[model samples]
Target: MKQRLLLATLICLPLSVLAQDSGTQSVDNEALTVYGRANVSLQSSDEGDGSYSDLESNSSRFGLKGKGQLKDQLEVFYQIEFGIDLADFDEGDDAVSNRNQVVGLRGSFGEVMLGRYDTFLKDSQGSVDAFTDYEADLKSLFRGENRPDNTVTYYSPSFNHFKVGGTFIASGDETGDDGISVGIIYGDKKLKKTPFYAALAIDRDVADYDIEQVTVATKLGATIVGAALQQFERTDGLYNSDGYLLSASHPVKQWVFKAQYQAVKYDSDKDASISVGADYFFNADTRVYAWYTGRECDIQLYQSRGCGASNGVEQDFLAVGIRHDFSW
Candidate 1:
């Protein structure tokens, strides 16, 4: 707790100093943005044992971020984000979780950040995971999805739609060795103005595993198709696995249809999951959606234990939800 508090102070102190020094300038010279998303769902889940219903909070979060211009074309920026659990608010510490909180600088040399944030290997997936934050999130099958503290990261500006990034994670007296994550990305993940997106990333000793991942997505007429391949190896060499993900989505007017499939293979043990869903947009900021996910595994693969099942059992989930996003 003390360490976290100190890290927060360190991140905020420089920003405060910069704000005061820039006081002489117009307020418009600096922008403070408040952004958030509220996503909740009602779910009917079955884990090969029994079926139950509950409300779930799907990675809902709020954050504040801003940037202040400095001399030599450099700028200072910071962000503090926290996840909120709307379904069970009284869960104590679990109710509120830390997310990508960081202080950084950007200029001609590109950008550098310090604090707690997602590693480059994790960010390389982009928006390919159509079922992100859901029961079938890709993090369940892949090993590189990590957000660690005591870290420094760097990104180079895009050149011809290509950019490179890396993260250095400090062990902080916990281990004698540190970790690193690096990636090279091309094109936009949103596929807005870009026709395709691709990324290759690798992680060493992050989250107890070494990983190599490649992700690609492209628009085919009105539909978007995406895929990801990953290789995971434990640092201790006790385990190794390979996985792949395939996803697609299509939009018709205000409604969008989506589907995803993921599988992992390891030493004769296999895990797989499938999800299909649709979203109806009230506008760009609000939407209602429904999805069904089914997962089966030969061994425990994630914290949720492969759809909340034990070993060889199959688990299933059906969810309907609403999401609202706001920014200022």
Candidate 2:
């Protein structure tokens, strides 16, 4: 707790100093901008034994960002993002500029950034995750959704619909563990008729864990479909796991209907989940949505024993919410 507080203070101190130095002239209005998304929901969940409900602030966040040309072919950029926990008001409930805080250089060759940021393995998944920031999020059962601190990243220029990126993490504070992540993505959004996108990614934590993943998506007119597969391996060759996700969406006018299924098989356990949802777009930056997700998992109580039938559990969730995005 002390460490987090100190870090937050450090992050904010510099911005405060910059804000006060020149007052109104501190930032270039033409290059600097503020952007954010606010997502909130009323949620109900069933755990087989009982049911419960609450209001949730699903990863609502805001950020300040800017970029400017540095020379003939180079540019410099910076961003600081924070998470707001509207549903929780306790001390430390809000993250002080915790998301995608980075400074980078972009040029004709590509881009290089250093800061606390998401790994390429996490970023490459893209919108294939139909139920992100919710109870049915892909991170619940899969491993590669990481945003580690003290990292350096490089992205290659796109060529023929292909782009590549890599991330390297500095030594861990206590354990001195180092990490690396790499990913490649292809294709772009097809707005007219049929279009496709695909990505492959791998992440490695020295002597700790390794993950490989692939994601693909395609659009056909008003319908879109996507899938993802991920595999995890531990250094000790124990507790290996794998998972897959499938999703589809159809749009009719201003409304979209979506559904998804995901499954994971671990060395000693197995789990599966399904979700269905719909969204009504009020505009490009605003929408209301509702979704339901159901999950079941079975576990083995003892390593030497068979799976326990009683160790299985089921859960379900229903939620309705509005999401809004804005920039200025």
**Could you tell me which residue pairs clash in candidate 2?**
none
**What are the RMSDs of all candidates, in order?**
5.4, 8.0
lDDT of 2 by residue, 79-138 (tens): 898888767566765443488899976766577778988888898887888888987788
State each candidate's clash count: 0, 0
lDDT of 1: 0.85
TM-scores of the candidates in the order shown? 0.89, 0.84
lDDT, each prediction: 0.85, 0.77
Candidate 2: C-alpha RMSD to true structure equals 8.0
Task: In model 1, state the lDDT of residue 156.
Answer: 77
Residue-wise lDDT of candidate 1 within 206-275, one digit each (tens)?
8788899999999999999999999988898877889899999999999999999998887677788999
Cα-based lDDT at residue 286, candidate 2? 98
The deviation in Å at residue 40 for candidate 1 is 0.3
Which TM-score value belongs to model 1? 0.89
| Candidate 1 error regions (>4 Å) | 1-29, 90-92, 174-176, 300-309
